[model samples]
Target: MSAMNKKRTESTETLKKVLRFIGRYRILLVVSIVLAAASVLLQLYVPILFGNAIDQIIAEQKVNFSQMWRWLRQVLLVVLFSGAASWIMNLINNRIAYRTVQDIRAKAIRHIQKLSLSYLDSHSTGDIISRITADADILSDGLLLGFTQLFSGIVTIIGTLVFMFSRNVVITIMVIVLTPLSFFVAKFISSHSFQMFQRQSSARGQQTALIEEMIGNQKLVQAFGYQDKASERFARINEELRESSQQAVFYSSLTNPSTRFVNNVIYAGVALAGAFLIPGGALTVGGLSVMLAYANQYMKPFNDISSVITELQNALACAARIFALLEEKPESPDPSESLSDVKGSVEIDQVSFRYTPHRPLIENFNLKAEPGRRIALVGPTGCGKTTFINLLMRFYDVNSGTISVDGKPVDQISRHSLRSSYGMVLQDTWIKNGTVRENITIGKPDASEDEIIQAAKMSHSWEFIRRLPDRLDTVITEDSLSQGQKQLLCITRVMLCLPPMLILDEATSSIDTRTEMLIQEAFDRLMQGRTSFIVAHRLSTIRNADEILVMKDGSIIEQGTHDELMKKGGFYHTLYNSQFVNTAE
Candidate 1:
């Protein structure tokens, strides 16, 4: 109903999420808390020791040297034990902080893997990475600070109050009267700052996404002479991020000073109260000294806690982003049935789908491929060519109708089995940062040396592979190879598996003509006795395909062999002639 109430509710939810992560290390947390309390209590006892020693040495000549030595020794042991406890507490806190962060990041990655492809297609990769990396790091910092300061501050506050009450009730009451002011100040500032911190985190994610997009496509930006526009866009996002961050920081930063002012007032009250009590014989000089020490210790926790609250607000904001990602609904569960020994018979009956319900991309798409049949899909960009392939692979479920493999619906089979049965090579190549052997053997990890070499040679990638420093063992990255080389490796990966079905999406678009011919020959040999779907933009590439389906705006306009379509003079015929006509120009 109110802003403060809403802020409290959000913070509590975020805190509960954090506590679930922390709850995994319950034993370690308990040990850390015990050590923190022990350390604070020991430190509180030191002030009493100082008061005793001070009272004993009222005069320098009459000072009890033996008595002082004993007290000094006890003080030394207390300090040593307190330092040890604090050090160990810090070590355990570090372990918990880092390990909790590790769990959150790992869970985020695992959840991302389970998410539907549609979700990933709609979201930015850079933003996901920022939440897992940068946001998680901030959470780790907050956890570490909370463990180190929050626990110790609470213990110090409680212990100081107990010690002060045993010495003088009047001074203790005076200190207690001013304590609420610090909490009120912290709560007021934190309430206003929480929303700003949330805004800052979202802006940070946007900036990360923009940077990733620009850097990832730097060549495209430069080639199109759009660098100035890109820079301007980045500047706008950067300015937004700066303004949000500045406001959040400015609001949170007020907590420390405002609370410190209240703490000082409390301290001044203690000093004045103790000073008046000494004249009435209600307190001794040693008692006054102890009261002053307790007052400082009491106020120190409030100051430290106010700062912790500020950090907690920022940390919770980041945690909320990460949690939002984790909360996304995962893909529906697959049936218990698993496809095995796939015969490559695919049937798409009345299949209809769209990214958005308002705009149809594929409607009533129907296709049936018997074993060893090759189906070619040809269309302009955004005509549902790739979307069809995505549906076939079960990347996205159809909005209507059934897609079956070997008489069983795709949804009835495990996704892992359905996907693994098909060998796919797309134009957009992906090469993980690893060795040449690793990349080639990704589809079939246990592939032998001979099998890997044979696949590489078949794909025509062995020519470049043999030239590398370590051949199969050479550590290579995506940037280390040319585009064509990367595509060749992707082709080799599929070639190694030689699955029951195949999908070639402009597989040779990046290779030169000579290499393309060789790879095409290899593909011909590989496609034998295997059902295949090819999405080709170059009309000439699909001339030999068994059945070419011409698609336009989510509908198949024509379907026939190249000669049949050419004789009929349909859309395929026009599209076929247009390519040669453009080349002639």
Candidate 2:
């Protein structure tokens, strides 16, 4: 197909997605429909009053004052009522549109929560936020304007035309001759507006990204003295946005004045022709008056048509983006593979994983651990220490091989359930701006106060917590925390979770040696009954583990008890000799 056809097809698909968003607001939408119809109905009566006022005096020769008063009062009443109804309809539409946007925000936020880590890694938070908030808002406003006004205006135009033709066909034909010009102008403007609006939406997203970057890295700007650089970047994006917005406005802005200009020309021409026809007894004065009124009515819908078409274009772009997001395939279907309990036992069998297809990390790796084992994975940097935890958690699927928790395949078990069974601690702690208790209970929302304190004690975090004014209820954030203290809070959260399996991926890498020792004691308490995987390069930390494995290039080359590995005269022996024994001696 040609490019134009493809564009049209894509626009239609976007409209369908937008319609689905509107489906939930059907009741309010229907009310909008009723009010629009009522507005048109009341509005349709004024022209008839003008025709009647002329017909009774000129055609029927009855100059009845009481009838004339009644007709004028009826026209005034319709005008007042139509104005009130239009105002109410606009109020309802604004409410409906605003509420629809709120729902979209809610849905997008929920979807973001469920997205996997891999997805978040591939996309920036600012971009995701723009899609939810700014993009969704554009869709709401654009659709609300396009749908409600387009519906009322088009209907009103048609009704007025029909009323005009029934009263006088000559003036109607004049309008009919001029109708093609109105549509031609509207179509031309709309087509240009479509392209301009695409640019407008693109610019809006770009502007949002720039603002987000500046906000997220304000400190970096100060640190690097990049205020001038940041200002230049922002100004460039702002100018681009302004240009695109002007183009969109220019196209839509042309439709109204151009339509009115054409109407004024047509009205003047028709009135002159009608004046000649009236002397020749071709048209009654009342019929000419009503036809002129309808001609004005006709120009309005066409004028609105131009604006609606432009808005539809913007809405189409937003709808397509939103639909594309909504249609994204969520993390692969995770089926239940583990029938029996986990029993805190795990084994990796000839497993290999690659972050990217070409960048093979772990190759043909195999390891086995007993129930309730405390295994430490030690290796130089760039080894597959962290990758192993990723596999066990199923954050990234293994390239080839099977991992099992309790002899059942990892992929076979539901990802949710598998993850739920394990407690993980990360190197960089994430402490939200909330009370200490709120952070701990985030892992287990209903964890009792005693349980929280008990877990905190196991992580050796309660010692610091007890010093706070409100203890558990005291707020702890970046504003209130030193790095080491924050790490303790994260550990406190993990301890409260107390899953059957624990994976600590450099969880204590940031803490001071003294705090590390205290944390290790707490971790030892926490690890007593569960199987734990500890990935650390520091030899002092792994000395007490039941088993120590030295990993390199994603595979385990040496594994044994600490003393046993030292006696083997292998990789583990070298790692131990280079770090621990040398430091001890």
Candidate 3:
């Protein structure tokens, strides 16, 4: 109901999510805590043994070698066992923390794969990457520190308090009275630092996105001579990041020293109280020494926990962002109806769609392509050419429409199966860092070597491939190949599949005129007897299409064969003539 209550609720939810990961590895976590407790208990016994040795020497009124030797042996054994347990606990904690974070990272990646294209289009790639890599790393580090210190710190504090109370109740009460000072200081500082840490994490994601954008478009920036402008823009973002980071670190940094200062004051009060008790015959000299030791031990956990709380706040902020991304709803559920015997007869019935609700892009659009027909979509730049293709692929669902293949509704089929039926080549090519052969065979992974080579030859890509060192096996980076070469590889990929339907969205836009002609010939062969949809800016490329649809403002203004539309001198004729006249000039 209130702001404070809302904040508390959100924090509790985030903490629960983080604890779920720990709970998944609960067995290992429990073992780690047990080992840490044993280690702290052994460590706490050493001070008592030392105090007994002091009291033995005082009672004997001389150096007692036998008692001194026994106490020395006990103390040494305790130290040895405590160190071993601490080491084992650390190893177990490391395994639990790393494995848990690894599982979380894996789940995030798999979830991203299932997300719809709309989500990807709206979010920055760099921000997503930061969440998976950098944010996950922060969480892992924080968990490791927390697991290593949390159980042991609590155990040490409790054990030390018990030892202090047994030796001197008066002094123990004094220590208890001052303990809350350190805790209050830690709590006050941490609450103020939490929001600052969250802001820093967000700013870091923004900076990462900006860096990715700049690096991805470095060539364009250089070609346009906008390096200085780009640098200035980056400088502005960097300044914001700096300010946020400084503020966050500044606030969190206060927690440790502030708590330490309070603990020091508590230690001083305990020593002063011990002096008064020793003067009264209520406390012995050895008892006072043990009390001082217990007092220091009791305050140590507070300081350790206060420092860890700062780091935990940062980790919580990162975890909250990561969980938000994971919580996004994936694509709509696939229907039970399977797509069988796809014949590539696509039908769009009264489809209406838009990226936003208020501004409609494609309204009441309809098209029908019979089996084996090649449909050409020609339109101005802003016309819904690509949007139409996106809907057909179900990359984005249409607002009001039914797209069917062979009378089967597209929505009824699984997205994977529906997309598998179509072979696509776009003007923008994506090639990973791999061998040329591997890149070409991506669409059809099981294609025989001969089939791969044949597809490459048909697409006119083999000519350049043969010239490369190792030919098809040659590894190629993104910058190693020319634009036309990349386009040919993409076309070759599509050809290897030989799917039932084809969609070429300006597939030849990047190639030279001669290369375009050769690729078009390959496409013609590839499209034979299979329905094809071609979106081309070069009007000449689609002259032989079975049907041409002239589009404007998201609606088809004219539709007919090339010669039939040319004879009518309608929108198609005007578009064709303008391109022809521009080429002539």
RMSD of each: 1.3, 3.3, 1.5
lDDT of 3 by residue, 1-585 (tens): 976566557667888998998898899988988899899989888888888788777655577779988998999999999999999999999999899899889889999988988899999999999899889999998888898887889989888888887888888888898899889988888776767777788888888998899899999989999899988988987898899889989888888888888888988988888888887888877777888888888999998898788888888888988999999999889887767788888999999998988988898999999999999999899899999999989999988979998898899888888998999999899999999999998878788989998988998999999999999899998989998899889999998899999999999988998888878888888889999999999898899999999888888889999999999988888889999899899
Candidate 2: list runs displaced more than 4 Å.
54-64, 224-236, 336-341, 467-469, 475-479, 561-585
Q: Candidate 2 on 1-585: residue-level lDDT in tens?
A: 977677778888777766777799899889888899889878987988967776667345558777777888888999999999888889888888788777767877777666667777876666676778778888888878976788798788778778877877777788888777878887777766666777777677777877788886888889999999989988997898899889888778888788778878877877787788878777778767877777778777877877777777877777666666666667777685644466878888999887777988999998888888999999888898887888889988888999988888888898778888888888877888889999888869999999998988877788889999999999877658877778888888888887888998888988888879888888888888899999887787888999998889988888888999888898877876788566778
Give the range of the ten consecutive residues with the poorest summed lDDT in model 3: 3-12
1-585: candidate 1 lDDT, tens digit per residue: 888788789889999999999999999999999999999999999989888877787675888778777878889999999999999999999999999999999999999989999899999998998999999998999889999999999999999999999998878887888899899989889888879988899999999999999999989999999999999989998999999999999989999999998888888888888888889999888888899999999998888888888898899999999999999999999788888888999999999999998998899989999989899999888999999999999999999999999999999999989999999999999999999999999879999999999999999999999999999999998789999999999999999999999999999999999999988899999999999999999988888889999999999999989999999998888888999999999
lDDT of 3 at 516: 82
Q: State the lDDT at 25 in candidate 1.
A: 99
**Residue 526 local lDDT, model 3:** 87
Give per-residue lDDT, candidate 1, residue 159: 93
Model 2 earns a TM-score of 0.89
Worst 10 residues of 2 by lDDT: 53-62
Query: Candidates' lDDT values, in order?
Result: 0.92, 0.81, 0.89
